[model samples]
Target: MRDYLFPTEIERLIAAAKKSPRHGVRNNLMILLAYRHGLRISELVDLRLSDIDLQSGRINCRRLKGSTHNIHPLEGDELRLIKRWLRVNSNPHSEFIFVSERGTPITRQSAWRIFKDAGEKAGLEVNVRPHMLKHSCGYYLADKGCDTRLIQEYLGHKNIQNTVRYTQTNAKRFEGLWR
Candidate 1:
């Protein structure tokens, strides 16, 4: 079964990630963007400096699972988080936005570790992983009553079937079912 965090859990995860002093800035940036943009761990790790445009507020996500690359909007607190990390991070010259302590791009395994660490700190029952953040993004958007096709495009899903699960999983949609 696919895993997804509720909106509250998402917030809790963010808080837990933020509470960590070690690599907190970078971890927050990575987790926040993964949720905001529905990015796969590979995409998150592979993102380059040129992929984001702060002025235009756009993220050019390179879809990895047989989907076409697409440009997505960037705004709100997510943008601010990116800016804050960039301002304080020592590796201003690194190609990748999410870098390791050594100033090199973090591997997918390291990205997974970041999410796992946050899950432990957040006291979540489910083991959090990078893809769960992406699923949270999908569920969050779906809960907001976003169109399925739009979510499909936003997520860079080549098949609508893959995106259909979000619609089925939107817990808010079933509110008052028996009432």
Candidate 2:
């Protein structure tokens, strides 16, 4: 009944997305960025090329639902993937980073379908909805011992309460209680 994907599951999804017959690079980058940056479907689909600063290895995350917007540093892998996608992009003129075959910005529905299909292709046990990527990012950061406040800001949560749940279920927090 877990809603978030483990790191291994995320890796599997990325691999599965890469195997797609069309737009494989685009699809995988979508998943990777969504998970890495804790982006909601709307946010992911709304991303623009101008939001990323390749020279600085950073991205301006435009959060929704009144959350605070922040710049997130892109990992080397993410940067490489993004560069690869850009080189193979169907339409270089499109404002959005991710685009459909027609060079239109990818819709939220299309992004959802891409994640779901990648999940199925990865043989994931849980139904992979786009939001799960966001949740997975939160949990991953929590499990890694990242400060709750930092995780909150990273996920763009206006309230710390929203971020606590990720840490609440982390068994590692109680690992030494009996000792």
How does each model score on TM-score? Answer: 0.91, 0.96
lDDT of 2 by residue, 53-103 (tens): 999999999999999999999999999999999999999999999999899
Please report the TM-score between candidate 1 and the true structure.
Answer: 0.91
lDDT value, residue 21 of candidate 2: 86
User: TM-score for model 2?
Assistant: 0.96
| Winning model by lDDT | 2
lDDT of 1 by residue, 49-119 (tens): 89989999899999997987899988777788888888887688998898877888899998899899998
Clashes of each: 0, 0
What local lDDT score does residue 65 receive in model 2, on the 0 to 100 scale?
Answer: 99
RMSD (Cα, Å) for all candidates, in order, is: 2.6, 1.3
Residue 53's lDDT in candidate 1: 93
lDDT of each: 0.88, 0.95
- The model with the greatest TM-score is 2
